[model samples]
Target chain A: MAIVVVNVMPKPEILDPQGKAVTNAGKRLGHEGFSVRQGKRFEIEVGEVTPTVLEEVRHFAETLLANTVIESFEVCS
Target chain B: MRVGVVTFPGSLDDADARRAISLTGGEPVELWHASDDLRGVDAVILPGGFSYGDYLRCGAIARFAPVMDQIITRANQGLPVLGICNGFQILCEARLLPGALIRNQVQTFTALDQPLRVESTRTAWTSAYWEGQTITIVLKNGEGNYQADPDTIAQLEDEGRVVFRYLGNPNGSLNDIAGITNQRGNVVGLMPHPEHNVDPTITANLDGRPLFTSLADYLLGATC
Candidate 1:
């Protein structure tokens, strides 16, 4: 079995409160001068990995897994 | 007039929306999100709630529901539709409305009586109110920040399609926009629970009654 992973993150111009909160938490934990942005990861298991399958997963990531309005997504096999 | 209120799996305010419609003397039709039929209602209302558990994102999964397919088709044909709170998120996801609603800047769920200025009284939903009228209604949501690209914001402003503006900017929405209408003025999306303020017995504020009355008047072909 092969798995395809998709990573989705908020667009740069959009505000990500969850990411800001995580950065602040990291600061409280003594990690300074670091910024973090939260995002989502989805793994799709398939019988076999192929170009066609990767394209299909990319389509799903664009249309459903991530909202293009406030998000950007990347697909990897 | 018949106004259909859609009820998705996690829709919490469908009953309140239906009640508001009934109180306004319109027949309330219950529409199921899993079904594609709208029951031939004169108008449709997508009420507030965390539909489909708000997975992936708020209203992301719910946007693909069978009912939304019909709504998208009918709305394009000039059918009147109103989306409230989570429904607003769904509308943006479905591309019926411009922009997106993101997590609140404070990263917290907020609930309060919010004051809004009516920016436009020309849509099917706001005809009963005078332009610039201020009304207070319930505002409750965790992800209610509205964002759009600069060009779209400029166009909405130039065209006067912004239907409502927040008086105090509760959720960090762009330009303090609380609600907006489509170019055709048949569809509206807002991140406030107007239905919650319609019943006087439940809440002393009846500011939301005008929204239902506006639709009723519009359906009756009355010039408000």
Candidate 2:
């Protein structure tokens, strides 16, 4: 199965260095209404993928991969 | 003793960490982030920098580097491991230690010589220091604030797990915590850069030398 770990961070309440840089470059490229929030995306190939396994992995990401203080994550197929 | 300095992509202080370990009379071995073997080093130092480009948050992507597999194993076996700044974030990311480093209170990269109070000398890295002794070390990072659930913080405090506290609130960390040691004292993570202050010319007062010296004194029987 294709297991993906998408690291999520808050969308800019305003002032995201990575996002701002992207937006500026996008505007220069003539792509208006472009916005982004910096985040991490990891693709892991595991032995098997199951609901229990997904929950376990989600918990792992919650405690390790993503900071809950200002960040959250989701597991998708 | 031989110490291993693991270099993940974007890691900036690998050389400085090597130099500090060498000055302490311990041989420094270069370990790669994608390798699972430690090459028989006595201890490991995860130097500061934007590992994995600080993607998915600082130290997050690099937490799963192949080297971390062995680091987890060795650290679990009581091998000494010290994580600095970005390295500190990785330790938390890898669950080798506890707590997470959040953004600075002011949300800007703060770089300066910060004074920190040594909270405990029980760890291999801090044994050279006296409890409550304050020393100045350099701090540089955008995401260095430390945050933990209240229960976790209380547990750490009640168990004397906190190892250092910043005299100046450079990052707005909870309890001004600058460093913490695991229950075994074998794994430690701190926000400041002790490796950067190893040289007298760099620190001007040689304040950060004791951390390396103390570790060498314990694991290698050699100290400057």
Candidate 3:
């Protein structure tokens, strides 16, 4: 079984509402160093997960997990 | 015609999408996230909302849903696949459509009756409108601006793949693109909610009705 970690985010130019909301809230609370965005992680156990299998998994994540419009994904084993 | 609408965990518009299909004279079948089968539907619609609560990006997590596998396979076989908002994001992630929905350059979640120019009536969806015709539909999303590398944008422009353009730039999308059709013209992705426009009780504009109407016309024996 291999573990996969994926990080997804809107491309730099895109506005992140959730991030912005957090940033604003941090400012209100006087929290320092608040530059925040969000993404997710999924851990799955697969059989002999070769590179091709990983790619397929990534494609699956691309098609379903992350919205490609605003988010990009990177997969690590 | 029978249509399948896939439901990701956080999908918010699956029910509405089904209702829209019913209103348009298509039978809507619900497919689950983990199942790879398409339930023998003629077309597929990836509805809007934060799948996985936008946990890993809007449509990121939903892309891996088993149903999408079937969708991608059948879409290549010439099945119609329509992605709206978050659904559009999933298509982009899937590479079935090029470009990405970035955060609105203005950084705002815009929800309103947005005006769009029908750039092409050549796809499985949006076939009811005349080229260059304008219509209004509801657009509500936080990350909906469309962008791509310079060459890709130019290619899309040159190919006339752009299917919809904003009547007025609302999300800071390049060239005001609100929707696009894939090379085969069977897959389409748009940021607006045509489903919301199907019922007058739900939306002020009926402009979105044509989207479904055209789908009904073609899927149920109407001309291209």
Better of 1 and 2 by TM-score: 1
* Number of the candidate with higher lDDT, 1 or 2: 1
CAPRI class assigned to model 2: incorrect
Each candidate's DockQ: 0.90, 0.15, 0.33
Report, for all candidates in order, the number of backbone clashes: 0, 0, 21
Worst 10 residues of 1 chain B by lDDT: B215-224
Which candidate's lDDT is highest? Answer: 1
Once model 3 is optimally superposed onto the true structure by TM-score, how far is the C-alpha of residue A26 displaced, in angstroms? 11
TM-score of chain A for candidate 2?
0.78
- lDDT value, residue B101 of candidate 3: 79
Q: For candidate 3, what is the lDDT?
A: 0.82
Task: Give the range where candidate 2 chain B is weakest over 10 consecutive residues by summed lDDT.
Answer: B215-224
Q: Which has the higher DockQ value, candidate number 1 or candidate number 2?
A: 1
Where is model 3 more than 4 Å wrong at Cα? Answer: A1-77, B220-224
User: Which ranges of candidate 1 are over 4 A from the true structure?
Assistant: B222-224
lDDT tens digits by residue: candidate 1, B1-224 = 98999999999999999999999889999999999989988899999999999888999998999999999999999889999999999999999999999989878899999999999999999999999999998999999999999999999999999999999887788999999999999999999888998887898999999999999878777333
- The residue-by-residue lDDT of candidate 2 on B81-111, one tens digit each, is 9999998999988888887887776657999
Residue pairs with backbone overlap in model 1 = none
